[model samples]
Target: MYCSANGFPALVVLKMNGLEYLEDWTVEEGAMANLKHLKIRRCGNLKMIPEGFRHVTTLQELVLRLQPSEFFERVQENGLDWFKIKHARSIVTKR
Candidate 1:
């Protein structure tokens, strides 16, 4: 998805839901630049976090709730998907 420069300047927190059919997502460079917290819920089919998150320097926290256990495993330290969000100060996963 593309986040325009004028989008949500005050949006520090974001929540996404009902993304069962979403297998992948790609973010444009500088997208969600000011987003500090992100909560993703019920995204069972989302295979991995977007690679573009590495550019979101302002992101401090990530929360994954009600996702598949396997999905949670991939985001753990040393896991395959960990690099995408390792910069975050906090990462929480719930299955």
Candidate 2:
């Protein structure tokens, strides 16, 4: 899909069984600046996110399932500050 006309970005919830072909996501980090919400599920092989994913000021929520690491938690803890983001709402991990 494409970004909004205003270019304000979008909220995405990713739910993939595996991340074998997710290299494109890392490669296109710059272009996905408008992404707001990201949810990754069962991506156990995923080691890291795009470099600038932490700087996505428009990012609102980050959700992860089957991820048990400090890195992912750190991203959720430090990155995507809701207060700093005007439209950023909230992050919800797997329950």
Candidate 3:
């Protein structure tokens, strides 16, 4: 949660398996501004990505390795496509 709200320039790698240690994605959205490669694993509690992520045009690769049954329980849940990223590396399902 220490990531700056303005923009995290030097932060590239983000691995959140035991995401229980931190808050939800909304609280960590600011840090994602300048991120390149992101790895989101085992965050079953997470519903969706943050809002400001649309501004993060620098992102390249993304790995979504976990999601519980209720991931889309509610309607109007904005999907990951809004990120508008370029050069997607890969999107693999662990199961």
Candidate 4:
């Protein structure tokens, strides 16, 4: 949410986990323009990545680890979350 600030720059790599009560996470347009790698681990309360995630053309890798069942399923090849990040060169998911 705070990443919506204009001065916010895309992170080359981001790792997040253990954030309970997290939902409806969203990133603003062009917020992560330079992001290349992302990792989400042990976030059982999260539902899905932001819709803007798809627009991060610079994103090259995405890793999901030890997440909720829904989060895992939704990121599969044809799942809802898949469409947002299908362009990423690599996507790894773990239960």
Using lDDT as the measure, the top candidate is 1
lDDT tens readout by residue for model 1, 1-95:
44654456677898989878877777766677788999999988988788777777789999999998888888999988888899999998888
CA RMSD of each candidate after superposition? 2.1, 6.0, 4.3, 1.6
TM-score of 1: 0.84
Q: Candidate 3 has which clashing residue pairs, if any?
A: none
Residue 86 of model 2, lDDT score = 32
Give the per-residue lDDT digits (tens) of candidate 4, residues 14-66: 88878776766887778877889999988778888888887787889999999
Clashing pairs in 4: none
Worst 10 residues of 4 by lDDT: 1-10
lDDT value, residue 19 of candidate 2: 62
Predicted candidate 1: what Cα RMSD to the true structure? 2.1
Candidates ranked by TM-score: 4, 1, 3, 2
Greater lDDT among 2 and 4 belongs to 4
Over the stretch 25-85, how does candidate 3's per-residue lDDT look in tens digits? 5524455556777777777667655555556666677666655545432211344543333
For residues 1-95, write the lDDT of model 2, one tens digit per residue: 22323333343444456665443234233445667676777666555555445456566776667664643554464553322333446665652
Query: What are the lDDT scores of the predictions, listed in order?
Result: 0.83, 0.51, 0.55, 0.82
Every model's TM-score:
0.84, 0.52, 0.63, 0.89
lDDT: worst 10-residue window of model 3 = 70-79
Question: How many steric overlaps are in each model, in order?
Answer: 0, 0, 0, 0
Error of 1 at 49 (Å): 0.3
Model 3 spans > 4 angstroms off: 1-4, 21-23, 27-31, 69-95
